[model samples]
Target: MPTFTINGISATVPDGTTILAAAIRIGVEIPHYCYHPKLSIAGNCRMCLVEVEKFPKLQIACNTVVTEGMVVRTDTEKIRKAVTGVLELMLIHHPVDCPICDQAGECGLQNYYMKYGLHKSRYDLEDKVRKKKVQDIGGMIVLDAERCILCSRCIRFLREVSKTCEMEFFQRGDHSEISIFPGRKLDNYYTGNLADICPVGALTNKDFRFKCRVWFLSSFDSVCTGCANGCNVLADFKGDILYRLKPRRNDAVNQTWMCDFGRLEYRKANEARLLVPVLRENGKAAAAAWEGVLSTTALRLRDIADNEGPDAVAVIASPRSSNEELFLAKKLAAEVLKTENIGFTSRTPGDRTSDDFLIKGDKNPNSTGAQLLGITEEGFGRVVKAISDRKIRALLVFGSELSDFPDSQVEALLSNVPFVAQVGTNEGVVSRVANAVLPSASFAERGGTFTNFTGRVQRFSQGFPPRGKAMNEIEILAGLANRMGADWKFDGEASVFRALAASSAPFAGMSYESLGSEGQVVAEGRK
Candidate 1:
């Protein structure tokens, strides 16, 4: 360990830890750009300058590695003056258009200006650098060279991680700017990551341009439903509308990046979200209140349970649901309905493993969590065989969106069941066969936890209220279990997780509070 003093606070960090990281650890805010934790250090932006004792010049904290007994001062007047001078120089060529810039409230420039900047400018009033309005950087990103701070974070990202090497610095000195070389363009599987690392309005997402101001937008931690890699994400919203998606840092999962496909899934929420519970009457869908829907749904299930016993009812859990929600579904089936034929459904391809990085083969967020709760491929096979026969009479299907399954096997299996109750965010094939249908909230509208491909459980809060009368899946399951006379005692997902960790073998030692940012995996040794 290397011992160092940052702003008079002594601390010990790993030998190679940078001064920026050490300063951050001791509550000193060092303004920085081009110093993303995941990306290689590009000491171009000199914004994280700090004064060190016995070292005359300002040091870039990002590239300055901590040494034994080193003393650093992050808040000295000399450091502030140097930082102010750098900010002024950077702002000279930068545009003063925060009103139109997409990165307004959260931009690195805004944060640095507030922390260390002169309220007045001292430039000789030379014409500022004027770049094209919005140069298309491939299909998904737009570039404005005038707004770029020459950080090279985007350029380095292209060269290093994505290995595309499309974006590069052009020319020399003040004429230098970020651009593609020759005929190549900034296009890659991980291109969206550059938009995140740009640190300014230089790179903007075309999908989120002018959609909503960042100040009005709120964020919620979530899991990417685009694939099985189960990348943890921040779902940014403006009131009831979803505006954008950003990758949340989870070292065990997707790390600091997400695919472009995952970023576009935010648009899906605005379309096809069921806002109310619909019951089929006279072969047409009709809206019904919660009291009416619950009573009718319970009566149908109770009659089936009484006549055909627990063997008659089956619950098909969705992998899109949370571990807490799925556990409640399993409990609803085995305990309340007393049916051993409970199974989870997904159109997951045969390969259900993970690569060295993100993108798990499972293709659903909580398959590991579901498997931990005792649901398995073989268990699903048993449910399929029983339903194929005339054994199971009723089915409760959750999250039946065809986009999730997109296969014929699940549809064929659902065809054999006589009576079905579909609880989901949309009306699908399951709802067509539904004797009673209830609207369940989407992942964005609910508070819950998901165990990603790494088997690390993470809790996400609801960013917006439930769409119309739709309830969270856990709440709906709790209500249904109560109606069916089950021993479900959970008041919410937290209680459900506590019970899950207590009784479930795999998660027996875990709790919700222990899950960290991006639902970092609980390391094997700590427990």
Candidate 2:
């Protein structure tokens, strides 16, 4: 342990901790660039210079390690002058494209310039070095060499984090710029992270560019549903439109980076959305009132349950659904509907699309949550068999698409089933075949928890209102349960989770508040 005084605030930190990190621990701000905690330290950016007692020259805080009884002043005149000089050199040849740059509001260069180097530009605008602007770098990133400060964050990220080594500094001196090797491109699964880690507007996400300004958008913590990894993310949206999904720092899961697949998955929330309740009659689906749709669906299931027993009704939940939704689905089947067959549709059974990183073989985000609630993949085959045998006359599907099941088998099963009720977010093949299509909210439009592959129950909040008449799965289920004479009074997601935690063994001692932004990992045996 080593004791250090950063801006007169004394604290003891472990050996080898940099002055920049130590300063951060005690609420002292040390302005820096190219000092990503996850990436290897490159002392190229001298913006973090600080005045160290007894040291002749101000040292870069990022590379300077704290020693016992060390005194550091981060806001001294010497430190300010050094930081101003560094920032002046950084912006010497940089373009004044702040008005057009996508990263204007969040750009590090702009921030530092206003804070440190507020001096008028000594060099003429035409005299500024111009390289490339809006150059199409591979993998959803655009590059502007003129905007780069050459802090090497992107270079180090590629070399260390992604291990791609696609990016490197080319040329020398003021002409030095980031570029990909000849015939190579920045095409990695984690390439979108480069834009995220880049300090300046030099590198920008191609998908997010010109879409919306960062400051105008509202962000809320949510987990990515692209896979079982359950990468924590910030859902950035404006009004009802989700603009992007940025990786939120979750060391145990995604470690400050998310794959491009998951980053772009937010687009699905806006595409092919099922907004209203639809009833299929004579192979045609027409928009119907929510009350009529739910009542008809409930009556059909009740008839099948009363005539052929509860086993005649099969419930197929989605692995992509939240733990609260899956728990309620299980409760509806076991208690209210009184059915033995209750399971979720496995999206990627025996999937091989996994990597050494965040991407998982199981495409479903809440598969572990479903399993925790006693729903398994084995029920998929059993329910399909029951449908084929004509034993299951009624099928209640939650968020499962026809593509989730074998195409031929699902088609055959749907044809045989007397009544099929589907509750989902999007308009898919299953909704077309379903007698009653009830629109349920997408992950972005609802609040619930998703248990990752390792049993971490992470909570996500509603980023926006449900599209059209689409309600959340909990609301849809609660409405259906009430229609069936069940006294289920779930006011919100919290209440439903409370009931789930009280009744379920795996979810015991867990609540929405306990499963905060980073999430809580359930005990191994409890799950």
In model 2, pairs of residues that clash are none
Instruction: Judge candidate 2 against the unseen true structure and give its global Cα lDDT, from 0 to 1.
Output: 0.87
Predicted model with the maximum lDDT: 2
Candidate 2 runs further than 4 Å off: 348-352, 403-409
- Compared with the true structure, all predictions reach lDDT values of 0.78, 0.87
lDDT of 1 by residue, 327-371 (tens): 888877777777787777556444454445565556677777787
Number of clashing residue pairs in every model? 1, 0
lDDT of 1 at 63: 97
Least accurate stretch of 10 residues (summed lDDT) in model 2?
344-353
How much lDDT does candidate 1 score? 0.78
Error of 1 at 402 (Å): 6.1
Q: In angstroms, how far off is 83's CA in candidate 2?
A: 1.2
